[model samples]
Structures are given as structure tokens and as C-alpha cells.
Target: MIKAKQIVKKFESGTNVLFAVNHVDLIVPKGQFITITGRSGSGKSTLLYQLGLLDKPTSGDIELAGRDVINMSEDERTFYRLSKLGYVFQDYAILPSLTALENVLLPLLMLGLPDADARRMATDAMVRVGLEDKLINYPSQLSGGQQQRVAIARAIAHDPEILFADEPTANLDTETSDMILELFLKLHKEGQTIVMVTHEKDYAEKADRIIELADGKIVRDETLRRN
Candidate 1:
């Protein structure tokens, strides 16, 4: 679980101060799927980055699993992120030169997993994402959806406690996007905590809760009932 209190992320322009995320307080429970939705410049992505520890807020407190992370050192934050968090970005973020299996294997290896164990975990992740046949394929050879799946495989190979996705379906077609969302939903059902930022209303509806923001402030936080 994660908690944020009075989080404010500010940026200084030439003569103006911009609030990327202003006075935001949120709590994400374990085994929950939450989506942050807003129009462009609404601070949705900024808020995601802050919660993911990819960026620090100007002022606020963030507690991850009851540990204060707002003031963690760079090395500590890096270690924590690698060990406890997973991320999927809009851009796929796959290494073009690496095969799908290798891409997923790299992160597991970084965790000090032995080669055999990492290989097994990476292959299982690829299979879970329906990319087993394409494991040996390079990113350039795979379709956009396949590439994104590879990215997801890499993120989940280590089985982190939380998954953070930013506009994960932004570049995919409708069918492909649906496929990806289904995969995410499956993961959520299996008890993976997820926090995603997206502009698509339809995708947001699939989450357990949706937090709508405007002008860097959360205007509505709605918990949707699932059948």
C-alpha cells in the first residue's frame, strides 16, 4: 500500500511558478487497481511519477509500505524501486537491440537472480503475456502491441509489489489496447497492485477506482462497483 500527504510538485519557469501536482493526498490499498485520469497538463502523469518514486515532490510525504520514501537517498530509492516497484511506460521502453526474452531477463539478473532462475522467470513472464513464441524476436521485428507486451513482461518478471503504468495503451489500436487491458485486469484479479495514468475514459472505467484531476488538483475520486 502507498500513502501521500499534501503532495506538491512545483516547477519554476522564467517568471512563473507552475504546480504540476498541487496539494494531492491519496492512499492506494494493496490488491487494488486504480487509474488516474485527466486531460493533458492535468498532472496525472506527474502524480504517477511522484508516487512511483521516479520524481520527488517539491514538498510532501510519501509512505510506501509504511516507510517514508520522500527523503530517501538516490541509491536507496533506486534499490527500492528496483526491488519493490514495476513500471510500464507509454513508449514501450523496450531495448530495440535485445530479444524479447533478453529484455525481460536483464531486470531479473539485476536483482541478483542466477542465470537459470532469471531465464525461467523471464520465459514464464513472456508466456503469461502471450509472447512465448516471440521471445527470441527483437523489438523491431514485433508489432507495437507485441513490443508493449515485452515491456510488460520485463516489468513483471521480478514480481514487484506494485505496478505503475503510464499511458500504456496510448500507441496501440483498439483491439490491441483491449488485449493489453485484459492482461492488466487478469493481473489485478490475481492480486497485483496497479496504478495507471491514462486519458482514455473507457480504460479508466475498468479500474476499481478512478481519480480525476484538473489543473493539477484531484477534482473527483470515484470508486466504481464491479460486477
Candidate 2:
């Protein structure tokens, strides 16, 4: 569902150019669970941002569901991102003042859905993440795991074709991380496409395929047999 060819992303601070993602080529098939693994400064997050269209690449191309991103207009890019891509971040990017249900419904609001339908979808998503009881809870009231689950619910509430997770388990305990992984696997089995960035080897091993990066380049690509 996503492809990148010789993608390069660089940042200029004064006179120095730092290549965060250097000539990285990646392909993630539909309905597949793929993990991107790397150390700090290895370009994993940059690559994810590029794939999600949160950041523009300096060079090369990104194709999502067959359309080249570089060819899209600014408004088209925004619409595409709003309707087709879902993002989950390590820091649990839930709105501090909004309750869990409201946060999940935010994407639907962006789509201009009616309030009733938005609430229905948001409730379903929260239930999917086992957070139905926390619907009225704000970010400050939920634990890290609960907050991350809320983020996941919000990300997928729109039923995006692709889900992008950056360091999804970074802040959760091992048990909670395992539960989240199980939820991801369940979604994957039901044909949800996922691209997750993770530092934990155990989580990486659970994916159908693992892509490792170092020094802004892919160092290893392996398909793991399901046990």
C-alpha cells in the first residue's frame, strides 16, 4: 500500500545539511504488519513521517496506494492524509482537555461527519481498544497504556487504509505492551495494514517482516515465519 524509492530527507541548520533519511527505499504491502527498527538518529522516525506525509522528502518519491505523493497538490495531500492515513505516536498524542471519546471522534469531525455518526464511530473504536469504560476520562486520568490505547483508537477511528505507529510501546510496561501488540495483531488479521517503528526486539520479531536501519540506510530486511 506504500512505496518509497530512493527517498532522501535532509535538514539544514545554518550551513550544515544532515541527512535523516538517506536514499531509503521501502515497500509495505496492504494488510501486512511491518516493523521498522533502528537506534536513535538512524532515520526510523524520519522515514515514518515521510511515509505518513507529515514531513516532505527533500528528494525521490513516495507512492501511497498507487499515487505518487510528489504529484499531489497541498490540499490533496491534506485530504489524503485525513482520510487514508492513521498515526499513533509514542507520546500518546491525545488532547489533554478532551475525553477519550472526544479525541477518537476528532478525526471524524475533520471529515465533517454528523455529530451522531461521529459519536457512534468513536464509541466503537474505543470499545475496539478495550477503552469503552474510559470514554469520559481525559488524558490526565488515564494510565500510559490507557492513553496509548486511546491514541490507537483515534488513529483507526476513520478506518484508514494504513496505520503508522512510531515507537508505540516505548512508554508502556511489558504487560501493557503485550496487550497492545495483541490488539495490533488482531487488527492485522482482520486485514488492517500497519507500519510500526519500534526499538524493542520482541515486538519487532512479532511482525510479519522486519526492516532495520542504521546510518540512514536499510541494513537488514527479513520475513519472520509466524509461530
Best by TM-score: 1
Best by lDDT: 1
lDDT for model 2:
0.92
Q: Which lDDT value does model 1 have at 79?
A: 91
Per-residue lDDT tens digits for candidate 1, residues 1-227, read 99999999999989999999999999988888999999999999999999999999999999998889998999999999988999999989999889999999998888899999999999999999999999899999999999999999988889988999999999999999999999999999888999999999999999999999998999999999542
Please, what are the lDDT tens digits per residue for candidate 2 over residues 110-222?
Answer: 99999999999999999999998999998999999999999999999999999999999999999999999998998888789999999999999899999999988999999
Name the runs in model 2 displaced over 4 angstroms: none
User: Which 10 consecutive positions of candidate 2 have the poorest summed lDDT?
Assistant: 218-227
TM-scores for all candidates: the values are 0.98, 0.96
Sliding window of 10 residues with minimal summed lDDT for model 1? 218-227
Off by over 4 Å in 1: none
Clashing pairs in 1: none
